[model samples]
Target: MAQRELVCPEEMAHLVERFNYAPAVKVGQMVYAAGQVGRDSEMNVIDSSLEDHITAAWENVGKVLAAAGCGYEDIVEMTTFHVDLQEQLPTFLAVKDKFIPRQDVPPAWTAIGITELTFPGQLVEIKVIACVPDAA
Candidate 1:
């Protein structure tokens, strides 16, 4: 069995301490991230605009990816859970494009709709699988 390396950004250390889960885990060259919600550093849900929530979630994903030595382009698969699938999708797509613009070959994606999430106001949660770059 391959060894696992945990990835957790300093700013998100509270999550490890409180939740007891690494934001992401790396094994071999693959990095798998936990679902990232639109919560601030203090873990309070960002109860702002729809766009803000989506953007914040993506930002959290970015942080996790960075900690794992990966980037948005390194993501090979993405899975999103949304509270309001039809109502929030248009706004989510708009925000998503900012993080990951349309490319010749985009990452595999799946969007799931659910009734609720960990937090009350969190509308979206994003998780991803990425490949770490080969060492030079």
Candidate 2:
């Protein structure tokens, strides 16, 4: 069997601690992306607002997917964790709309409220699963 290829964005190393889980892993045609927070390239919190954080988190997910040669359309599932789901749902949906157009198929999604995240002031985290194109 051929070895699978793994991929990640350069920003991921700065965003996640070295001792923590890797940003993304590919096995066969599936890519599993680690939970992404609202941190910038330096791992510093970007915005204090829940809406800002949610948008940043999703953007980070997109970066990782792009590195893996995938896109939002290739995502099959997503799991989101927020400190306050009720307060952030509308904002999350609004940001989601920017990425997933009405004509595109939306991926399976789940949202859960959490007490906290790995870093202080972090408001949202997102995990994604994407399918890679078959090798010709």
Superposition TM-score, candidate 2 onto the true structure: 0.86
lDDT of 2 by residue, 47-77 (tens): 7677778778888889988888888788898
Clashes counted in candidate 1 amount to 0
Collision pairs in model 1: none
Q: TM-score: which candidate is best?
A: 1
TM-score of candidate 1 to 2 decimals? 0.96
Q: Cα miss at 70, model 2 (Å)? A: 0.3
| Model 1: residues with Cα > 4 Å off, grouped in runs | none
Q: lDDT tens string, model 1, 29-76?
A: 999999999989988888879999999999999999998888998899
Q: What is the TM-score of each candidate against the true structure?
A: 0.96, 0.86
Candidate 1 lDDT at 51 equals 92
Give each model's clash number: 0, 0
